[model samples]
Target: MLNLNRNSHVPWISAFLLIISYSIANGVYLTIERVTYYPIFKSDFTSILLTIIAASFMTFYNYKRYVYLIPLSLLSFLLTSITPLILLLPIAYELRKISSIVGISLLITSSSMLSWVFLRLIANVNTYFSLPLMLITAGVPVLIPIVWFIGIFFLFMPNKKGNKDSISLNPLIPFILTLLVSLLPYLPYINPYKFPETVDFKYYYSWLLHPQFDGWFFYTRPFYLILLYLLSLIFKPYPVAFYEFVFLSVFYVYSGYKLASALDRSIASLAALLASVSPMLITFLYSGLEANLFSISLMFLSMYYLIKKEKITLAIILSLLSMLSHIYAWAQISTAIILYYVFRFMVSKIKPSKYEVIYLSSSLPFIFTGLLLIFMGIFPVPMSLANYNDLIYQIAVGSWGSSNMLLFFIITMLGNRFMKNLLGFIYAISVLGTLVIQPATNLIIDLPLFIPAAYALRYIRKDIAILLIINLVLWGIYMSINSVPKIH
Candidate 1:
């Protein structure tokens, strides 16, 4: 129950005050806690403060574009800081604020902050440093959600504008060549069968427990994994880890082509290629997060269907499948549905029907699952619900070695050009989050995929490709520094 209605600036100012107050309060508490008891955590206030500033800048930049969300975002951020016991109580309050930028911003910002703080507190670390503090504090809770907010906004932002897209496919061969070269790294690394000592390798290797079970059992849809495994047979019978990367890259490329075709062919092709080579996709080359690969592809495919055929039911089904594939897929699913509804409402000149609303509600079950897992901690498997900090250890090398990641994060967070492109912003933030939470290689692979998919933004934003390449190069540097043998 934070109030912003008195005036537009009131909530924003209030939020700023709240954050400053909380930071000081939290810092003082930490100092006292340490002095009283051999404090379990040493606060890295330098890193924490830096992360907050960076994250605040990123969030502020994005929220400024849709200024209405600031109050809600600020409110949500404060609420999340309160104990988790009141999580449900705040739901109704947030619901009343939903349509405005304030509500959506609050939702996104609060979720990010809550997730960040939870990871920090639950990890039971002896010291709090800038890296983890910024990561969970600003990066996860605020920046990522801000990106999500922009994406959702773009999808539904009432295209009150029109355009004539005539960027013909110039030099298709060159485009394909660039895409192939960019993606060449994903081709199976010459076999060393043993999992490389990177962060997410073990999480994926867990699947080796049922290597013969077919990843299809992992989810209801088998087409994605099945198709990838079969294609790998044509090459060498590599581990599904390699195949997941290959298939996701190809599918991401094709999906971008399909989505971009709605705008321009060359742009779509470039976007597709960028997606194929992005850090996110590259990381998947080794992480074996097949579900992420599969579901994202399906989400884009569903968008293609919705735009082209107006196949609402089919689109809904695909979206649901995408949601089921992974918790992360929720952002994509929500963005797509929101865009579809907004488009139909505007173009068809009709209010949303009951069915339209119901169809959109399909995403709720997944949301519920996430909430249950996050708040109640009623997870199905203890391993699946392993504290998010585990991702730090599992994906350590790819993320950064303390200083490296923090530095890279500072440079990227402050300088990432894609921040202007809402989708690119989200992708950029996501890559950082993934680096912190998952294995380094997995993040490396997955970054490219998410970048291109983000282009589904209705506006033909060229910055998407530019920013993606920047992230890609940064990731390459990270890998080169690691001196992990390049299996090429």
Candidate 2:
């Protein structure tokens, strides 16, 4: 049994020291790995001295507060070496019992680090596993965070009969906070040639120089290209990238706020923050992949209006715009529309409203375009040969990969039963589609997961929701650090 005091500083201090020790060990390991040739004393002495100091302070200050830290610190310093963060997970789990805030924070940090390390390990392993084993290995990182999150919820935030009044806060605060936190990790990478390595930018740049008006432009999203062209007029490439980054960030936060507002104002803010700090979203933003960001922002915004049954026209317009932004967006928006109507028919037992009809009808043009492409035999344009092993490797990375779709389905089914039956149907289909198709870049396809998650957050305690948000931020940070820059 451990101390379970929310107000106590002892557990917080212990957790902080554990993080510090892990950081020191990781820094030393990275230094050793980076240096081609390292002097023994320079590497060994520095790491050993720092590790001892960190471990000694941790032991002296609050050894009784968390006895597990003793072995964790020693093993982190001596055994795990480069992967000390994984050793802090048990400490985080224990801390949750004492202080939910510190406990969940450390839990997210450790879990995210473990995900990164595991993904790297999978990539390095030359041997292959059977499909089932590969699926399990890929799912480990994605599933661990969800499992731990559920464990924390049940352990600390047991559901009670009476519901507490939701907290009231101006939505702008979250929007601003999200913008600040979302910008922090990518601040250093902002420049005129920001993410110049991405091949997609070439198309935008070329479209800016010469406007294309032919029907052949179907493959290229005209609206996104036009926006890039306009931005290019006033700013250089880097500034254009920054402007798009800011634009997309604002919308991302706004979408979260809109979706969350359906349940509670405070929850809306937290959802916005979580969505803004999402690792998948952040990774795309930093890479200057504005097409997907724009598409996703519109998707969320449309979903918000669709859920509230307000401003149906605006939702329809936004849905269309999202479709025009990217082919991926088109697929996601189309799927969402089909799902929304099907869910309504099967679960709600109510006829579709006129507004819903309008929304469904609006998708026709995009659908027709897709069909026309296929009929003309111009769809699925041939590309360089794709390696199935590499595709499996990407899925195994657990960074918003295919495994997440399955996890999201489980989460949907467990969190809200009605929602599980409703959104769960859509999620199941999406996951199956992802498995069969396994598109090269599939993050945008996972947008549907956030809908059920937002509903789940509404029902949970506020503190628990905040814990989830913190976890999202930590996950985003890890992805940003480990992400490979796009090659042109």
Candidate 3:
């Protein structure tokens, strides 16, 4: 497992790091603000409540099963905070250094590494002298983003060896491949000089960068906005390109790999390899379609659990997450799951079993949410005939460009193949419908096309598939690098 000795008190990560940090900062800040004027909280209700809940959970969880514990981020915070005190240097100087590009990178990386190490060091806390230290560097506003990165990093490195209830990360091939594949596109966009490349992207960067979450932006897509809001705090001084790398890194590892495993477990790696390099995937990853990206990520993950496995509860929860991400994608995901049920029923000529009925019932809330959105006249993207042909072009060829015509031809040829698995067929059909439902969402071909394309690849001769991988990877890299024309 991730435990160091299985007796440590500091849960894998310093569970209370975020809440405790916020409590320290916001508690003091709010008290001053209240004396100045009462606009928000009378006390630190927000942070306190979260802190209490997190503290309670950690307390209860560590009671019976103490995983190797280390105050992963806490130790780094000690180094960041206490060192200056010991050396008799002012902490403000250290804080200034800590916020630099190198400093921020170190904090982020240290949190991730220490989280892994802390989970590893879960046991033998007495040996380390267990203080359950969850301190921050007094006034660092970087805690939220640090915690966010550490949360996602846990997925990047899962505990392969676990107890009976522990997750099975078997067949690590797809998981690892998908992580690399999903990460490939955003590398080129990370240049400091490059702007967000689109007007919408610029607006989103601004909207989330602000401390206040004003506007209907959050109302429409709370999931993506909250994530972007946290990221905005981290990458505010930098270009939006940096934001894309972090956002996509956390999102697509689950989406891409799970989508592959959902379709066909044996060929999951090949599926991820194919899906990650899709022209559409590469294109939209840079298009500033935050809600779409997050929705599709959840959609793919939900699909993974439901398709090959029978994790109804998880599928339902993730489907709801997708709904919160984007109504259109949720609509597609809900219907796809329901239709998969119908497909099974049709083939068997029998009614759905009890749990299957429960699964179907999960779509009711989504339907209501979708209808509520319509009645409220809060359409996310205005439906128009204008984006139809453009959507098709984007799905097949990715953006308007003559350079990828060869890639276009190949994707189309491969996309035409029929999926062998029924769920794969249903998902492909569901995503195919997105081409017409909304213009922008059609750009999300990675979740839909990744698996079927991989299935089609299986039909090819081994030598040809190898050639196709190389060819696709080169084009994928090319597409990624040239995705958004760099603004000087």
Top-scoring candidate (TM-score): 2
TM-score of 3: 0.54
**What Cα-based lDDT does every candidate model obtain?**
0.40, 0.49, 0.46
Q: TM-score, each model?
A: 0.43, 0.59, 0.54
Question: Model 1 over residues 1-488: C-alpha lDDT tens digits?
Answer: 22233334333333333343333323321111102111123234432343344234333434433244334334434443321112222222322211333334333433443453334335523233322223322222222223332443343333233222422334353235334433433323411333342334444445443344443344433444445446545654346443344445566667656755544454565455444434344344433456666777777676566545566788788877676665455453454355546665687776666655665676556655654653453423222232334543333322332212222232223223332333343344444444233232333333333333433322323333233333433333222222133333
What tens digits encode model 2's per-residue C-alpha lDDT throughout 1-488?
A: 33334435444555454444333333311111111111111233444444444444444545665445555555533553432344345445544333555545545544645554445444532121111211212223333333423422332233433324443456676566556644543444322234442334565566556667555454546677667767777786555643456667687778767765654455565556556555346445434566877776777778778767799889888887777776665665566567667776887787778877887778766777765674466655333444455554443332333232233333333343324333344444444344345454353334544444555555556675555544555444433333334223
Candidate 3 segments whose C-alpha is farther than 4 A from its true place: 1-200, 211-215, 231-241, 246-250, 343-348, 384-446, 484-488
Which candidate number would show the highest lDDT if scored against the true structure? 2
TM-score of 2: 0.59
RMSD of each: 14.3, 11.1, 24.3
- State the weakest 10-residue window (summed lDDT) of model 2: 29-38
Global CA lDDT of candidate 1, please? Answer: 0.40
Candidate 2 local Cα displacement, residue 137, angstroms = 13
The TM-score of candidate 1 is 0.43
Off by over 4 Å in 2: 1-139, 142-170, 185-199, 210-218, 236-238, 263-266, 343-349, 371-377, 381-392, 395-426, 440-451, 454-468, 477-488
The all-Cα superposition gives candidate 3 an RMSD in Å to the true structure of 24.3
Quote the lDDT for 480 in model 3: 43
